[model samples]
Target: MPLTSVEKDLDALTMTITADFPVPVRRLWDAYVDPRQIERFWGPPEWPATFTRHDVFEGGESHYYMTGPDGERAGGLWLFDAVDEGRSFTVRDGFAREDGTLNTDLPLTVMTFGFEETDGGSRLVTVATFPSLEALEQLVEMGMEEGTKAAMGQIDAVLDDLRSFAAELPVAAQLIGDTQVRVSRVIRGSVDQVWRAHHEPELMKQWLKGPDGWIMTVAEQAPEVGGRFRQEWTREDGSDGFGFEGELLESEPPHREVTTESMIGMPGDPARNELTLTPVEGGTLLTLVITYPSAEMRETVLATGMTDGMETSYARLEDVLV
Candidate 1:
């Protein structure tokens, strides 16, 4: 499932949901930022939502109602506290009357949405903060957790429509070894530019990301065969993030390079990464081969998704190259 985990912290009075999408961060962000798009996937399939009013700026108010299969209606309001375009946003959510008036008698919560670009795709972290542990537990008992998951599960369909409308091409991948898969892209830059984008820490920071809001806060690298590199990325608030480190197994400038990458505080062993750059007619052909320690690992990675991240990263690389 796209929804990976749902964690509720009693002491902190917060419930957070982690979900990954095999779509560009910009496209996923639009699912929330665009009112027309928001209504499409804002509720479970059985209880679709309709927005009567939506304004996403700071202090703006959005009013919507979800209609159940049985014709029951649940109205809600989102009082925007802050909005960071394409990266994150904070809102005060609560029940509302059909006329868009806040229902003070009902439960209210503060919600924050954070988006990050990961190696596989875009990771969306959503946190709902309640007034107290009691309030949180009460919502959980009301099936808020399950409802939210069901609602988010529909995001893939929304993204699929957007993808079709944009007519974007998917990245191509091929099985090159028993435990390896090769993903390739034609980058619109010279071999030197493509090589720098992959080898130089500064250049790498510009395009090696899944979504739009995140920045490579720390990028340190050494190009020698025995040298090591580290890259850390985080949101502006630093509430959720991760870093990875690796050692260069082979370093041939502008042509080939290899490394073993291991994530901090993550399961599974390190994976081997090999990159090849070939000069092409109008640009450079960049190919990346990832070798897993086991066939199961490789299959798992493919099953989870990787094309969106690769396509987004390449698109960003083209922007940087231009």
Candidate 2:
């Protein structure tokens, strides 16, 4: 068991758990920041987790759910309060409803996770502060301690498997619930460079073209929140053209951006696209979570070889960065 100790303070209304791992601090930190790795052990053995969204910066949020053996699911949310890179981070944790909103009836907690180097490897200290003694008691009665221990017990295997979430992997998309999908890729560039590549009109025109023989004719980036942006592409022969336009909803420079995207001339609700860039070991991990109008719309979009096209464009982006 990786858990070294678990302490509860009735007066402080806090529960602190300490665990030791046989890896460097960076490796352990990456395991938590990367959704692909974190989901492996974020839930108990029987209730495996699936993270639909994970943004680690301050003011960000994460949405995840654990699926029980019998297909029952319990949702959770994390509102990031502070982040100190690999050292420590804090979040307001609470239960979430099926619609991805917070369950107000459940008590929320403030959890801080601190990491540091140890003689053998590294240590993780998590302190969860409840709103009140009653909240702490309620959680304990729900087997919080036992479920946490069971969850942490599976981390060793994830840390040892280095090839799974490596930077060399191609663009991959995973379905989230009924109307959402998470697309992930690692660009061989810094977070700033990757973010610029997506925003700067000149740079975007250079590498955003999906496959060969197509050229980007228009690249208009939204300068700020509530601004509109558009991009259009055409084949070299000036045939089979398409475009997309939308308004920027949220912007956190070099880290995250949220926008609405819809095909030009298509009369339908626009999809919500949330983009997050995080610096990982080999490069910057780019995660784009798209929420469509319906499951059918999500399927129709993905069935158009979107992932392959994205892979091609990202590969070109790496070359452009070089």
In terms of lDDT, the best-performing candidate is 2
* Top candidate when judged by TM-score against the true structure: 2
Q: What tens digits encode model 2's per-residue C-alpha lDDT throughout 218-240?
A: 99988789999999999989999
Where does candidate 1 have its weakest 10-residue lDDT segment? 162-171
lDDT of 1 by residue, 1-322 (tens): 5899999888899999999988878777766755446778888889988665455556666777898989888989999899886788899999988666998887899999999998887999999999987788888898899899889888888888854323133467766436877675667888789888876777888888666667777788865779988888886677678788989997656666779988877787899987766443346656677888899988887886667767887898899989
Clashing pairs in 1: none
Report the Cα RMSD per candidate: 21.4, 1.5
Cα lDDT for residue 228, candidate 1: 89
lDDT of 2 at 223: 79
Total clashing residue pairs per candidate?
Answer: 0, 0
Q: Model-by-model lDDT, in order?
A: 0.78, 0.94
